[model samples]
Target: MLDARREDLGRMLRAWRMARDPAALPGPVPFRGHRTYLTQLDMALLLGVSERWYRALERGEDRGYAREMIDGVARILALPPRQATALYRGTGHQPPRRPAGGVRPDAALLDLLHQQRRVSWICDQAWDVLAVNAVGARHCPWLARADANVMTWAFSAEARYQLRDWEARWAGSLLGRLRLAWQRWPDNARLDEVVRGVRREPGVAELWERTADTRETSDDAARPMYFPLVAPDPVDVRVAAYGRFGDTALRWLVLTPEDPTVAFP
Candidate 1:
């Protein structure tokens, strides 16, 4: 029941909007910061095209928009190139050839992850192990044996022992995100593969069969869980899950303590 043209424009606006950085935008920071303030004129100038032509393209009234123009607009908006291309394609426009540079972490990102003494790791939207810091590696031995998967860690016997309240604390949150993923990227092949793989993992398989619903919102705080380290007392860690789309293949995750400790203090 949705108008195709309107939907395309709306998606273009949303993708471009969310992709911008507040600090990078002009002005003294508007109500919602930089992303919201980037206007049609700005988009036009960024694409090196006329305002009229850009507006027509965005409005889905023009089919002659150049692929280079869309690429330029995506670059200026900091939109993930793939999603940006999808946006253009939705509007019946031809997108540029796909870039061959698949999700390679630069030296800077590698260094950042390697230097983190805290239990921190990075996973892409498709749940690929882009990088894991040393402390995170120590905290998660599975990171060594195989690739890192947040879901796999939650379901394993060792991890379940570490996180006692697995169902109450973890399942709902992860499932909620999975539902959101299903809605956002219905045709995502990688996501489908991950869902199938997780279902095959014992505990995760059981949860997949269960018909229960739990919602995860950005405002919700992570449920507190204690992990028994070799130390005399259990290390209390607050598990927080956050998502941002920069490199479509990169999502940063940080797990820190509710109270300060020597190493993380």
Candidate 2:
């Protein structure tokens, strides 16, 4: 793809990357100078590709790219509708049949969940629970269901019971992140529905306006929770977060115990 059109693509890619709002970017993006534009290396990490490969692709020196990889870039950069269409067309990859098919849960990602001895789960950018491992299911039974969502769950009575200081720590921060996700994916109907549902809760609509500094990965801090199986009392947990795998459509998270010796229930 080293032709003239390919050269145009390379330039377009560079421009799009520059114009992206780092605040709206879905994944962890390192700050760069004053712009805070996502660097090539950050793009590589989020796409689960080597920096060398991503550089080659950006330069249009790479050929026969996978549709999933380009789609991942589009998602991260929050490309405009026209530009996104052109990017796919330029890459020669067919568009997904349904909007919902755009970012389906990865089976391979789900398989990884089962392999984790600790509580682990896979979700999409919208925080929809696609799959949870046995340990995760046992620990948080609410997460095992098909329609489970992180945003909606945190507002539920179950979450209030399980989480200590549920409103101040968990729900407020999570709602802030959901707003950021919505900024990145305004066209995402599922995520929009999530925001809508979360707002309908008492006082949440007003609360949404105040949390402007949160992101999905902001849940990294140790959270106090009541895990009946783990202990009779509340315990502080460090929830480890990860991004996309080979499929580039999921987020894998594991809730690691603070005590290394603590066994999975």
- TM for every model, in the order presented, reads 0.52, 0.58
Decoy 1 TM-score against native:
0.52
Lowest lDDT block of 10, candidate 2: 24-33
Measured on C-alpha atoms, candidate 2 has an lDDT of 0.72
Clashes of 2: 0
Q: What stretches of model 1 exceed 4 Å from their correct place?
A: 1-101, 203-214, 217-233, 241-246, 262-265
lDDT of 1 at 127: 60
Q: Pick the candidate with the highest lDDT.
A: 2
lDDT of 2 by residue, 1-265 (tens): 3777877898889888887766554222334555657678878866678898888777877578876688677767766667777778788876543342245444565566678888887788778765677788788876654346787888777788898988777776677667877888777777887788888987787777666657555567778888888888777778777876454357788888776777776
lDDT per residue (tens digit) for residues 1-265 in model 1? 4567655776667556555664442111213432544666656554456778766665656455565565455544545667666766766666544431235556666566667667766665556554566576565654432234565565566766666466776666776676566567766665675677666766676676573564445425545554445354555566555444444556667777656643542
Which candidate ranks first by TM-score, i.e. highest? 2
Off by over 4 Å in 2: 1-102, 213-219, 245-248
